[model samples]
Target chain A: MAADQLAPERDTRAVEAGLDALDGGGELLPPRPGPWQVFVRSVLPPVVFMAALVGVWQLAYVAELKPSYALPGPADVWQTFWGTVQDGRAVEAVWVSVSRGGIGFAMSLVIGTLLGLAMWGSRWLRAAVGPIVSGLQSLPSVAWVPAAIIWFQLTDAAIYTVVLLGAVPSIANGLLTGFKQVPPLFDRVGRVLGLSTLGRVRYVLLPAALPGYVGGLRQGWAFAWRSLMAAELITYSPSLGLGLGQLLSIGRDLSSMSLVITSIALILLVGVAIELLLFAPLERRVLRTRGLTTDR
Target chain B: MTQVREQAPTRNTVAPPPAPAAVRVDGVTQVFERGRPPVLEGVDLTVAAGEFVCLLGASGCGKSTLLNLVAGLATPTAGRVEVSAERPALMFQEPALLPWLTARGNVELALKARGVARGARRTEAERLLELVNLGSHGAKRVHELSGGMRQRVALARALAQDSSVLLMDEPFAALDAITRDVLHEELTRVWTEQQLSVVFVTHNVREAVRLGQRVVLMSSRPGRIVREWQVDIPHPRAIESPAVGALASEITAELHREISRHGR
Candidate 1:
């Protein structure tokens, strides 16, 4: 026991020395990249891919692989794309489709969140709709277009119906999975704090499940975009305005490949732009603050 | 902080006022899993208001289970735990502070749960932090602080609950030797200043001897309270003092004998 007494005193002195020797531990944080480095990292890879795509097109053209109308050069596609943009036709078409997608997406967001939370309330509810919601996610958004036409018939309501059907399941499933993944430790802490059921959900469960819920929102947007395109192509009237989907359909009807390519490019650009400008930054901030995933 | 368990009947009464115990656990038995033997069997203990009692035990001695039963986090299979306080604030060996919240925010949560007014929560939380010597570290994230600093923040959060009793389950066990020593002093100071009754749990004999006014030892596997000592040493006792060392050795020998019985 005397020996044990001396040992802890000596251990205490060693621990004190160790404490004095320790640094501030700032080295654990990753260094911030400079502006020039960030710009290069973001811009260079995409530029290289675009260049490679153009090179492949040019090579096919010079070799006379199929007629000029069959595989038009990148320059021809750009010309038609530039023409549409300069005349404000592309911009108008974008506004029409994006507004439709945006409205549908907002509705789905509310509906999906409510449905997901309802699923969390009981195992029976989860067992009933859980598999069905997941199954809906795998079904193509375009597959709903015919039924939507029969139900709403060439109206803006029909397009919205298809868009909602496409996006709602993804958002709902994301929230369901997110809630399921909340750590049991948080439940113990919640009970200790004497939080009410609503308080526990608000303060603990919701924020803890945010990463997965946001991931679902991102997927929902993709589905909404695709559904909007499918509905627009199939059910267009002059009253509905010429959306990008209609423009692509018109190009096919008129046998102009350049117009078709231009529409495809605009659709791809919108999807990429939304992901880059909105969801990526939101996900990064959430993951970083929670210490879930580091920026590096 | 003394609670009058009952008021006079508004007339002259001859009965003496009962000195209410902070906590009373009578024949507490805990059976965690069905069809398995109970983890704790027929354990009884009482902690008086403002008294510091250390529960010393071997590894599987169900000491934490006893603390949980007192904290109202778990129920005893047979027997009752009576506490005069509204609810006992519990501190774990790990800091257990929410990582998403700032240090002050963590304390504010306890105050919020206790139904303190929104306008008063911030000031109350800040005062608690100041009591724990973490006034300036309120805005810092959990990971930003050192282990000892985090534990101090946790202590502040526990105090924000405004409970008359505090239950600590090896609260300083994970800290370094020097840090643990500093925390023991800090805890003793805070405990006295606030007049909080505490049931501190630990396996270290020296820690039990140093901090407790009374020490209770338990045996393992369906843990039972085997022995107890009322330590009469005065406050501000040092761990390295000869008196603490002597009592710790005596208790250590008893603990060894208790453990040796399991080998057979």
Candidate 2:
């Protein structure tokens, strides 16, 4: 009779304790929101802000706030953009700019990585070249355009030279800072484990410095693209196919406002697409793995 | 109160019975000039094969400096320090497990560095983890494990080196009391089973008494060995038992005396 009476009470207390454990000791389930909650939380505000900006732009255009040449309407820019695409020159111009940017960026990545490694590995090399690298980074790539033209005689080589000058320093500086930030704890750990110099570089230092290196590459690509455009605009050669910069120059010379707007729009679009599609995602993933990003 | 065991005569001890001295430091002096006085002076100690020794001292006593010398991460300015076989494995105060690697991968890295055979590496790493009682945590990332679990993985990594001598610099100092007590028990069990020589450095007096067969007390600022106590208390020492408490008090008092002398 006593056992039967106690059993139910004991079970009830056990259930209560389990509930307490769930609530107080461990991570509990978060309260769920309605089906449209996330959409409301994430999507609504951004859409409203964009709509507001567009409304303001349309109002300004309707008010005749500025000359059409100086500030084209969104409709005019869109029409110019669509017309270029329909005629197929926009596609060609994009291909020309991207190929140049891609090739230049790839070359910069290799050269910069090697130079950075050299600077990091040797004290004498770092002492000799480190200051020069910093000085080069500070000096604008446009400053190299005159020297590059003189050296390479207004060809693709000139554009390539300017791009290299622009991008290499950013990449090298990124890696140098990254190498410096690697904690001493890792080096000690490597030494204790008897990692060879090569093994330490491969297994520890490189992996630790990857995020910084990737950041450098991203910066270098932007610099390379900018330098290429500037060089192409300043040193127009018929032999070199018309890139976006060349197309913009042609539009300006001919006073075709629509063409000018179209080329400018294409440049901006390509830059945004590269950042959004590639480097941003890459950086986010790296940061998330390192716990540098919040879970949410 | 249980009677504390007195030290056996040094002469009758017969030089710890001629077993291989896994780690031998003879008149090791480390001097650091940080624009100041020397840091360590004439510190001599040894760990016999399979013996567990603790170097106990206050902060700034160069205990960590001494451990660094043993680990070969830093060279001593003066005197001979030798590990009979290979480079001794080291454990830092923090878990120091690479954040990028999982628990098992951390151990595998040590094995790889030691040039363990590819075919044998996985099984050997698993065995080490099992010895540390973390057999099921092989797949867990370093950050996912609790502090105690991380230390256990570190212990497994140290074991992966296959070094007869293990030098630990207060590996449990950061842990909470309960976690520390559990680890102490775990360490004792692992050390017994592996029969590896250990040189553990710490400031905790009871911990020194609990885990060490011999506890060497070091004095500060150009640290030197001032006292050596050989604990003969039986396995699984009860921290609150009269014997453990009495010895701990004696060591604590001796440490206080050494610290006081530094004012002179």
Candidate 3:
């Protein structure tokens, strides 16, 4: 009876000692950075970079290194910007291009995501359609302008067709890469946990492939934007209103250097805005949550 | 021979009442290539319900392959493997937790795959975390936890499956010595409390003796069970104990011999 009692005490002491030894390595918790610190760390560097870039442009203009018409001064660009806004055409052009790109890009996203899923899910489908998608990706979106115009007769549908051709392959390929890269261990774990095929796709497969999928979406959007601009420039219809591409064409036809510069700047600004304001945040959130990218 | 007979009654009494062994492997042979020799040849073993069995072998001994076969991730080229109930849960050397999920979400995923209701998942997940003494770490993301904490969370996730059989492939090999010892104790307590049948594969003989009731030693190159030792030592066996050290040394010597044969 005494031996039994002593054995329990000894066991408890050993467990306590083991636990203490492990805990002696100190806190296993990660230190959380303050919100202000994180915000400043993330936001300040980009702002500083932009400021430096603008300053350099202004300095180059002041130095008079190039003629105003060839390389317009910073002031010239700003004045043109204000003039376009005053005429209300700048806002109008932005609205037209943004609306068309939004609708066309949405269509491309759906088609691409579906195609990607098909490519990943079925070997036969991939064998039949995979190379065709790769070939499409290699052909520049501008190359499709003539074909799109001929097929849709210079209508909005034709512009959308070009955008779809440009974006679909990118999205599909991105998802395919993502799906293929999911670790076999995760699949095994999923199977042992009783995950059905659909369940595995929904949870493990999709989440694991998200980074690659996001990368594809980013590439797809770039293609969609470029394709839309190229199609708009070529297929000029009165019903299409006046997009940024049309403004550039009109500027070229009328020989208005200021209008040309303003239109080009606006196009560049919209692309940067979409990337920085929208997709950048989305990608950062996914990466940060997945612990793939660290803010510090 | 007399000692084996003397211990038979105690073994029977200790084993939980079950129709057959929790896992049964009969003449199982795994071949790497059609023309090559088999990795595991004509191996037969049975694990009783609630019993802890350790498979100790050196590198290239195909111990992990055997575990994988039992887990149903790989098939034996010859013979059969049978599990009494559901598929066994598997734990790897690395925690292998989904990087995107919190500690609780990782466990919840297991329950979710088993079709547990969403309303009950949170509670059940918390319960599992509590069982692993990490009840407060439900919201901690995978990257936020230390290596030891991550493995504990993985252990919780494995247990959440609630399967009769658990297959562990050196789950603590990546951890530091101190953490591994602590986890060994934690694993022992949980295994006894839950009454699980475990087929733990490890290269460390001390680890095998520390946790298992039966340590099965396998020879390399067409891995086969060369010997089996029944550890009569009680729970929380000291690593430095005379019996534990003696068995460990014996197993190590056997492993060295098996490795040298390959070199020759």
Each candidate's iRMS in angstroms?
6.0, 12.6, 5.0
Question: Which regions of candidate 2 are displaced past 4 Å?
Answer: A1-48, B1-18, B34-37
Using TM-score as the measure, the top candidate is: 3
Worst 10 residues of 3 chain B by lDDT: B1-10
Every candidate's fraction of true contacts kept comes to 0.11, 0.21, 0.25
The residue pairs found clashing in candidate 1 are none
Which ranges of candidate 3 are over 4 A from the true structure? Answer: A1-73, B1-20
For candidate 2, what is the DockQ-based docking class? incorrect
Per residue, candidate 3 scores C-alpha lDDT tens digits across A1-296 of: 01112123245435544554555233343456788877787778888997898799888878877776666776777888898899999999999999999998899999999999988879999999999999999899889888878887968988899999999999999999888878887887788788998898788989999999999999999999999888888888888899998988887887777788889889999999999898888888888887777653
- TM-scores for all candidates: the values are 0.87, 0.88, 0.88
Q: What is candidate 3's lDDT per residue for B84-112, written digit by digit as tens?
A: 76779889988889988999999999999
Q: Residue A193, candidate 1: how far off, in angstroms?
A: 2.2
Q: Write the per-residue lDDT of candidate 1 for residues B6-101, one digit (tens) a residue.
A: 221321133322557899988888998899888888887888888889999999899999998888988999989998787899898888887778
Q: Indicate the TM-score of model 1.
A: 0.87
* Model 3 clashes, total count: 0
C-alpha lDDT of all candidate models, in order: 0.84, 0.81, 0.83
